[model samples]
Target: MGNWDHLVGASWRGECWAGARAELPLLLGVLPFGLVYGVLGLQAGLPGWAVVLMSSIVFGGSSQVVFAQLWGAGVPAPVIVGTVGVVNLRHALYSASVAQLLAELPLRWKLLLAYLLTDEAYMAAVGRLTSGPRSAVRHWFLFGTGFTLWAGWQLSTLGGVLLGATIPAGWALDFSIALTFIALLVPSLRRRSECVAAAVAGAVALLAQGVPYKLWILLAALAGMLAGMLAQALQRGKSHE
Candidate 1:
């Protein structure tokens, strides 16, 4: 959130279309996620409408799955809300990382971007965002990426709603989520600090596996960040020596 001085009137349609195109590969994994969620929601006795609507309302992917899982288990609404909120706190880091790129946008654009900044969408847009100098046109790029993902989510959830249990559980499309993340994460762990962070986080996650509501993800993420920071600090110290 910055002042309006840097705001430019220019917007690029080409960048937006390109961004949408770029996001297509990521959706391959994301579509099955919605399908799995949809099937699980139905099996949980969530009304079809609720399952479909959750995609738009919660839109937080894993958090939504946690919500449905807890809901099915008859968890209290307050507890569900709290747990989901805790899980979603990772987005705070995402916002912090991308804040500068979007700082110049007006309130409406900021709000839209905030809503659209899901995990896959953010990954899709971030490269373009940091690839070069900031341009208002890049906002459209994010819009394209985020909107494509959003639409994919909605449509896939709908597909799941319509398909129901007709799809075999054995197909195990859920694995795609892990595969997608691996695709995103492995390439980025090029530095020693990143590798250290990832290793520490993975260990913490396995150690915290029993924690409910997928809270281990948040714990792992925090540990990874701290480890990465410490690694960077030690590296710098050694270099200075």
Candidate 2:
């Protein structure tokens, strides 16, 4: 029995390492984005510690960027909260998608995974879970990926903060945040519905650019989701016909 248990433990560890290794490529993009956030947060007058703390706590790149931008603009705290909440609504969808697979996990495990569930981590985990033979200890694979990413983010944020302090503000590194978002967004626009949704949302954002409290972002996200849903539905209908 002791040998059997030892073998199982070794297998689990192997899976975890495999998952972390598989996720390394995605970390390339995440590292740069984290650096961008750290630099922008510092440039926006956020204390270095607060910027690093935010990365550790929030762990969501786009939302963190939005928060830094709003906080730097002197937006009210309540509004910033609401805006960040809206921006992170996609995580709910992610949770729902993976909930069934993780239903057997303990509450503590679920909570930990939920907290670590960023875009890159989720995509990597879901692909692993769906494409391969389902392992009994697959959640450990997720843990490995999430933990690796968490460490990478913290280190990258720290590097950016340190580097940002020495760089001049006139260089305008903050604009790179928008470019980072665009880089992330453009790749996800492969489907027709996705393209339509992005186009509509971009137009709405431009049109509502003057909206107070950055409400335009929320409106644009909603519009994009709706447009994508409608387009998908129409495609399904045509397929049925």
TM-score of each: 0.75, 0.91
TM-score of 2: 0.91
* Per-model root-mean-square deviation over C-alphas: 5.3, 4.6
lDDT of 1 by residue, 53-171 (tens): 99998898778777776787687777778778866876876788889888888999988888988888878877777664457577887888999999999999998888876866445
lDDT for residue 147 in candidate 1, whole number 0-100:
93
The C-alpha stretches of model 1 lying farther than 4 A from their native spots are: 1-11, 167-188, 191-241
- Residue 239, model 2, lDDT: 96
What is the alpha-carbon lDDT of model 1 when measured against the actual structure? 0.78
| Residues forming the 10-long window of minimal summed lDDT in candidate 2 | 1-10
Steric collisions counted per model: 0, 0
The C-alpha stretches of model 2 lying farther than 4 A from their native spots are 1-10
Largest lDDT belongs to which candidate?
A: 2
